[model samples]
Target: MRFDISGHYLLLQAFDRTGRKVFGGEWHGDEAFARDTEDPSGVSGERRNIQDLIKTLAASAEPHNAILASDADEEEHQAASDALHQINRELGQLKERLATLPHVTGSWLADHEAFKRRTDIESKLFEAFRSGDLDLQVGPNEIVQWRTWSRQPDFKVLFSMSCVIVPRSHAGQRRRGPAFIQLAAFEKWLCRFAGAATGTEELTPEAQLEIWLREKIKGPKEFSKPVYRAHALEEIPELSARAFDRVWDNVVPKNWKRRGRHGS
Candidate 1:
């Protein structure tokens, strides 16, 4: 992926149990990401080794003007763009594939004591959070995540988490997963969408974490309510090795991997 990995930005996010932003900043480096050779799945990783560990992160760690000589030419630049496109496509496919699992709300979880979902809102809690109805807030940059809240062009919320987490299950065979939306963005986007008079009071990272923990423990129905089913990508059947090969073969140009095709 390095073929096109250069020059692009990444918004790597991290939050504690209470969904508070302990640290947040942009990460910029050609060598930012270390290799994860052991990860069976090609999705999220366990931790970051100090390249820049914080609560919020953007696509490129370095600002644009700062990368003058280091930036690639037009063709090389396109390759990076293409790489991002491919990564995003994989993320999309995985998200879709995981939509059929038992999940809970709160992008981050604390209590493992399972509960049941309620029909109070006439919809699931996750849907509500994503609907901008809750008007959530996360992190410093205030990236919001939702379709209805898409009106704000500068809003940087993640609509759904492309990654999957498989927890130690006591509930059943079904894998547990949930979509995530960052704090600052989620709140800001909701305010924009709902046209709220006053934006939310900025809370310290500790306070923010408490808010998120309260919400998670409270469950989907504003507290203590639970949502049983959710989008669980890990449970989705992985593409057969052969299928992956075939897709790659079709996607890669014939000559890209051809050496002995002409009886050389």
Candidate 2:
């Protein structure tokens, strides 16, 4: 859209499917003159047309220049929109991965205190371990605690993760558990190391974790089916009992149920 002030009046112009003048009149900076120039099809509204026209005129000295400037502005806007969409897409993927991580709770960054604490942990971990100097090991079971020194400060860390196997329902059913527990833990460690080494705090913990998981770990060679549904039960306190109850219902021996139904 473009406009020019000539002979003490404003001339409005814009492009459409045909770029033809749908309506033409004199606007006196009042409501009635506005009504006179309004096109019911709304190829352009008075206020927006005027604003766009002003912008167009400010960009260049000639009407032809204004058209070129408007086209450039539109192209720039489209480029920005595409970039924003890409960022949002990547963010959604990060959130989904973060959701799969064990011990993740609440809407990401919703709780101020919890967010700060998590980020602090991420920062500390990144600082202590990014160099790959500290000795690290994983065991088959039971939580572990270790002490590490970095940044002229000592941090004591206690952390554990394991897959809770869900056995098959029938006689020949296979066992299953959530798949990403190990991956999540690995990513978490990498993100903390990144925070410490680079002093980058803007990226979400999840995004940082993803970068390290992909680049440093190169992912696990074997992929497993993830039991994502089980996480919902764990997240809501009211539903936690249901998870255990369902497991007992399925896994407890038939004789145990019969025995309980009858007597001690």
Candidate 3:
């Protein structure tokens, strides 16, 4: 599970015990969630750290119990008891800290249902664009506009469409243009839409690499970037070294340790 918060938007994704994705939701807020912090990246890192700690604590009980049940010396027993006590203390603190954060209240759909709804909306938008029924026209600074077929614009469709189609930097500009979108943004969105309709978006470089890493690497494994790159290329011939470097750290599991001279 992960909660990715940025400005007024939050994306939450969750997986079941078998690691199958069960829920995915995107939320929009009237006010920013991280107004007190200037560093969004830092907030993301902190969230991940908290999640890691939760996982670690959840798995620690058996090991600590084993030590207590064994014929260990007094010192060892004392250490295990102290560790369990510390874990409890941390868990209590975590609960209190989490309670202080602003609660998100909204409706959501299951993963499959959400995907179907999104695909249906994108297909309609794509068909409109392809049929030239949208009546696209060039606006200022490479922006594209279309005439609304109905008396009022279909804001719901436009809102859903823009979430996946519009670039984050140009989102504000879109609000100003109202009826406009960036032509520069169209190609990427078009490709994404086509891929979704055809079920090929999962084959993208980023998606492929994420799948590879999760399958090949496991807990406590030493991650050597050079070695991983070589293996990844063998598995995915199209993997770009520069692109891999750019996202390697972000995609790697939190518990993975760097090996050799870079190990920490």
Candidate 4:
């Protein structure tokens, strides 16, 4: 739906889920206004009009020179995501070939080396987590770890990651988060070893690991699928508030809410 997000938020009371607003606000002389509809092509048309307007201005200035244009950080992330895909595709193909191979040979050894290097990239990238790794053992379940790390001197944090390594026979099913998240490992080494960015035909280890973590280590829903459902928001609102506050600074609660009855 089209919106004039300028001025104050002209909040929509109850918009039709199926309805879309394409033309909004006053149309200038020959210019068209937005139309509202939930049609599949409607939003695309609205966006295309915006894009055309942007293109007219972009000719004179760089792509992101306009106020409405995306920031460098957003573009950087998009580039990284694209890089992740191209590298992993080759890894998938190699895994398929390895599955089909029967016996060991010189060529097989070379292929094995390729596999080892791929895993090593994942390992080395995440080696920093070792220093503050903690084993949080739960009864008869997969192991969980709380990794402690500090970036600047003032800020310290504990990040959680779990793992379950599987043999080749179970490689299809056994996937988990990246090995080195404990150490801030994924960032710096990523660009160096990333195959997708290289334009090299071979699979990139960095890209492969990205895919690996995505498929293996999902949200808590994916992690605890068999045993549980999602937790209530009230259960950890404070933690959630802290995470949100880091981005917005406004969401952080001022003073704790005292608990118990008797007007406590």
lDDT (CA) per prediction: 0.30, 0.31, 0.45, 0.29
Residue-by-residue lDDT tens digits, candidate 4, 1-264: 111111011111001100111112211211111222233344445545545654553453432244224555776656645554544454455455545544444644444443443333323323423433322221222233323222323222212222233233323444332222211122222333323332212223322222323333333223321111123123323323333223222211122112222113
Off by over 4 Å in 1: 1-174, 192-198, 205-264
Native-referenced Cα lDDT, model 4? 0.29
Say which candidate scores most in TM-score: 3
Per-residue lDDT of model 1, residues 34-141, tens digit only = 221222222223122111232222244233323333566877556656655664565555455445332433421212111111111113324545655443333222
Poorly placed runs, candidate 3 (over 4 Å): 1-159, 162-202, 253-257, 261-264
What does the lDDT come to for candidate 2?
A: 0.31
For residues 1-264, could you state the per-residue lDDT of candidate 2 as single tens digits?
111111010011101100111111211112111111222223224334544554543443344344444756777656655655564565555555545544423432234333333334334433433554322222222121222222222222222121222322211232322112123233334433222232213333333323332342243222211222243233333434344344334323343333332213
TM per model?
0.16, 0.15, 0.27, 0.19
Q: How many residue pairs clash in all the candidates, one count each?
A: 31, 3, 0, 16
Query: Roughly what TM-score does model 1 have, to 2 decimal places?
Result: 0.16
Q: TM-score for candidate 2, please give it.
A: 0.15
Pairs that clash in candidate 3: none
lDDT of 2 at 133: 30
Rate residue 228 of model 1 by lDDT.
10
| Lowest summed lDDT window (length 10), candidate 1 | 113-122
Q: Which has the greatest lDDT?
A: 3
